[model samples]
Target: MLFDTLKVSIVLVTAVTRWKGLETRFLLWKSLPSSIDRLQHFASSRMCASVKRCDLKVESPGFWDALGNLEDGGLDVVKKFFELLTSFPNLATLSLTALTLDPLKLQRVSEIHTLQTLIIHDCRLPRTFNKLSIRDLEVSGNPTEMFPASKEDYGLASFFDLNQVERLQVSKPTWGDPLGLFCTQSNSPISFSNMKVLSMPWTLSLSPTFPSLLTQCPVLEELRLFSQAPKTPSHSKFNQSGATTLHPSVAPHLKIFIGPDVCASTFTSRSLRTLVMASSEGRPHDIRKDVLPILTDIAFPGDLERLAFGVDCLSDPLLDYIAGSFKSLKNLSIFISMVDGERYSSDIHCRKMWISRLSSRLPSTLIRFDISTRFAGLNHSEDVSGEDLNVLMTPLSQRCKKLTAFTMSYQSAARGRTWAWRRSERTGYGSGQWVNTDEGVRQ
Candidate 1:
């Protein structure tokens, strides 16, 4: 079975090399149909060197047990895996998803010379996650609980210097337990001076000095701060927190800022041209209008081109204020969170009033509009008809003469699809190319 999978992989690889026009992607792990225990049978010495990239997920049901018992001599199986990785001196990307590895095994893997991208998911940083000099890095999923309880200092932030990390994504800590999960007690800011693109959950307690360090990243262009449920509040604030001053234009190179549920007022920057905010059900209704005024008050050197609002908040004033404020705004996006029973109001008048108010404030410079909502109370096809969606975007769409892209979620778009499908064909009103397919689009 193992030999057969390898033959197929090799054949597919050849096909990929031959058919340059093929748009489909082939996933070896999914296509390979053999138990991992027989891996040695497939990866002969010659083939080992030919493999360029490999992903070894630790969460597979019996994988850890197999790797841990690699030698019947214990742990050597993992050692052999590294041996294979080292053989591929040209390896570019290695992704380990939802896998846990022994620390000693990681230390040995770090010795490999030519690794460009390394990703670890739901895995503990084995001093090696830090020691490697990979150009791209991604650490996702929940923080592991098996880490030592006494050493919270082992948090990922302390493990490495992210100054050279180009694309960094430290996803939210879903289950925070066993103290040392994702943080250390330093209370000082960590730095990512060379990070070009950063996507971190809002709950991350950045060191107050983080902004100062960001200034070092002269090439940094995009910044995304996602708000996870708040982490233990940090006592540090701007002035009272005795920390170094945060430079006003530290992120001067930044052109985009995407975040939701964050008090936009807390941010002060001069280079931001694209702004995205995600609102949830518990969000403050007036935050849009309240925060927009403050955000606009801070002068940005560049023209604001795109503005997006996530639908967690029920307030329409926020949308209205945005339309009225940034006259140079080119694109607008609205994403609605799933409404709970309490938020569901049958009164169409209230809904109409909200839409009309938003429509009245539409800005003339806008070119693209995206509006989406998750209807938790009603099945879109069963009860809510498509007209509802048409009405929803009608107000915003009618005003933007340059409107080119209009996107909505599957359910949200389904409601608007009936009308939008037609309007989109006539006026090119369909969701943008990105709206139909972008991971974590709303969140």
Candidate 2:
């Protein structure tokens, strides 16, 4: 079996180079022509030029039907495997699955230059594969008609040059109009100006040119957007007849924002500090008419620490506007359900009166609290005792006296049971359990 998996990968790379003196830089070869001559003798060994990192999965079809009987059909064995990965020179990082290169042999594997991180799945690239200068890039498949059939066609606009990409992820399952691949058509403007991090794909969050494609990522810290509904009443009537506008030169150094809850008030980051919304099987008056008027017309920034939502948009006037607006908040995550209808009601004193009205409106500079729920009328004729989880963790440990950490999880809805609890304010003590589906934590 591939020489006993290369003799247990040379005895786990000589016991991890004799316990971490370091040598094996990481490599995974799943179906590369059954060890293509032992990976061309470890790519001309010298310990394969100190392999930096590599993952290759060519999904064997008898190695492309033996290169369909040769005749350059195998593109010279994929250009001798990118000329043996440009002789490693501290190989940066590469992952390719279901490979299909030849964007002129990926410009000779993008002139190596210590290739910085590239991940591709269901591949096909070659319109000079955007002259790589990779600084982290991810591309997922199903790229509709590989875009650009006009606007003087340069679709994927030479993969947007923000001085050689800082971080970009492009997923396609028909990303229809990613603002025409980030603008062009005599409306010239393209800038990712040292893009920090961006993850987008729910077909570009139902594009109405998705808030003008976050004004071309100007100093974006982190942003993730994924969607599977909401926003289509003609793009919520062109964002309430204003024909779109989030311009504070969008994402101006935005600090962490995750998508969907209908694009949470189309964003206006005052250097936003971590906000995640996600949750939509649509209709709760279309998420309180498109995310409660952009969360009552955005103005969040008391150095907002972290906040996550979804308890059907936690309304009580959005938890009294997030406990009277984030007083330098400190990590809070929530996703509730308890399930019993008329809009949630598995009553345990109505989920401890919504966690004692969100622990008397949060902020005493709280510290780490995560809550997840499901219970949906529990099941097996209801059960959750231990005083219904101490009536939900004694009003969140007596309204957060600088809580060090607290987590609660439930999930019963019959035949999918789970229960968890944890507490640790410097181990003042707390723990609970009942999770197992083929054995997973049960104490």
Candidate 3:
């Protein structure tokens, strides 16, 4: 079954790649000089099996990209790689699973205007491919030197520009020089006017006024920024010339803001309705001062319907502040993890105080309430009784009379946590943890 699953997945990926147009370039990596034609026949045989079973189209060839193992050698066979890309004029999506793009070859590949989605993992683009037009992009690789250093520098940037992209996903070791590569700089001032959904890791030094550009997206509804900063402190000066200050123009139509890291406090979006500031590390100052204030100060285009606060620690002041933020909060979620405490006893007191405070103020306003706990104690013997959990969540049940969804879970039981809320008529905990309404665990 495992072997069959692997085979089926590979065939499906190959089919999707071929459909999106990635066939010829894929053949290049499989065929060697001595027996290229015969190997092509073998690949055709495998493909024919799928074609016979299901309807498959193969009218035009595509850039089938399969990077050779780098341990064998480093970028010595790039000429052959380019030969593969040029074979397919209609290649739409190129998947590079390894860090092995020859700069010149990437540039040549970019010339194919039919390319729509460029999914790169570990591999950097050839120097020539920076300015190419790819609408949907996903990149996962090391942060060190991801972008081509200069316009003349033969690397990733030479083949592509991300300013016009509609959907983008970037997960790297860190966010280094985001504006220089992803956003526009002074010399390369560009606009992602059509960009809608963006997901990236956090950085303290993202280019200036980049936050304000969120207003530029006419239809942007979802924004998720994951935390990627190191635990150690590093104070770096923000260069004045590199800063892009937010003025009036930005993503005016944005509706959902999902920030998973510590961002600049100056972010302001008038149309934002759902704000999710989720954190695994509970920092008191960040929630009480930085994030919560943004929601209270700005006025949403519509009533701010949903709000969630996810952190390792739950504080009464933060809870009070959140209760005062909006008059029309429909859904609310809080995940609290204890910080360096021996037992759940000390944390429970703090948690109860916050929960009680929320209960008093949230009766009329809140429709849904989600609260979870994370107990500390390195030993595996720790346990949380069901009665205790019921007692803890008791306040939420009483205060939120209009509550459509009410949930609570114990951290000791939910260790190594990965859970979601179940979607039933009223409310249900899908995977064993707390979740609000139908959105499924708040992104």
Candidate 4:
């Protein structure tokens, strides 16, 4: 799957091609307005040894400059680019960014039966959901960004049969504000009957577009909500509910959920294994209120193999809950940040117990454990000594016999040290610590 920047995605594209990720990553870094035509031309070229790659470069001084008047002929380029797909009979994946597609053009490309995965960002699509038969789709940008004003197009209601898509990831709106999922709600034909995995921004959960969208994908195994759950006017009331509760009867077969607190306690899923309940995007989580009381309240707690969350400060109860809830954990990552210049559990003994208790609870099946703690509130770096960090990591690394890697960092010390597991005569204790010396082959 493509690692889309606008989407809360990385793990979703694991089933697709390696080239597919690169194709999508390229778009995430920059718009490919000029690359469209050049990509089409490169496939037909045989004499690359004598050809000048510079000719395929963008003719426009900048991509933005090409947007209006000829858009550096971007529209014309994408029109011709569509024809290139019909040439690759076995082609199954296509990732494009920053382009536009009219209704007829979208229909023409949809006819490619071999296509099964489509990853696109910042592109204009047909007003209605046309018959695009892709199984895995990662999309952003508003549907109305560049759509034509045709009466035949009825927005997302006709984007194709939603049941055909098994995996879906959505990030930013195509353009401006989102198209609101669909223009007309009751008459919409969208369905997620076969959806197995879905990743979207947290803010969308509060928007009107999300309410109807969530109920449709009941078979989803993983649901990831990335980025900050912004306090937008649409769903401001749900802010206080962050990391608090899970909806009952939601995705009975769900194995992963990484995002903010959705409403209700109908969580009947017995297969959930990964739960990351916090605001990501590197934002500070407040210690004013207990950020994790919601952890104990999850309907079917425990049995999670991977867990992650944000915290204002470490506490005995919080660490204790983790040890009791998840016993067979393999991968764990924690995001710790300061809130308003102070640690919540500031007592020296409390901090030391947090380290010791946490160090003992790490399971042996664990391969990777990452803790990113930043003492942002302290006035001096010395306030958080390196010795304390060592006390925490050394035991964690040594005790977890199967650990493959671990990292612990403090904001004061910008360059966090990393320890990786190796097989042979590596520079480390009998176990693993990534000895940086120029010793035998480094692992």
* lDDT head-to-head 3 vs 4, winner: 4
Cα lDDT of model 4 by residue, 1-443, tens digit:
32211111111111323674563321212334555545555444332222221111122333333233233444444455565555545556666555445566576568666767787665555455446766888777555553445555355436656678898887775322223443333444467889898877665665544545667787888877665433311112224332423456567787777666443223424566776665433455543353555565565655778766666566655665666676677887765656333443443223334656677766656767766555544345344344565566667667776666665444433333333333233645433454332331111
Report, for every candidate in turn, its global Cα lDDT versus the true structure. 0.51, 0.56, 0.49, 0.53
TM-score leaderboard ranking: 4, 1, 3, 2
Model 1 per-residue lDDT tens digits across residues 201-246 = 6444244434544554677787776655432111011122232344
Identify the leading candidate in terms of TM-score. Answer: 4
Q: Where in model 4 is the C-alpha error above 4 Å?
A: 1-80, 126-130, 149-153, 174-179, 183-186, 228-247, 262-270, 280-292, 299-302, 339-353, 379-394, 412-443
lDDT of 1: 0.51
Error of 1 at 368 (Å): 4.0
TM-score of each: 0.59, 0.29, 0.57, 0.68
Choose 1 or 3, whichever is better by lDDT.
Answer: 1
Model 3 lDDT at residue 391: 53
lDDT score at residue 355, model 2, on the 0-100 scale: 55
Question: How many pairs of residues collide in each model?
Answer: 11, 2, 30, 14
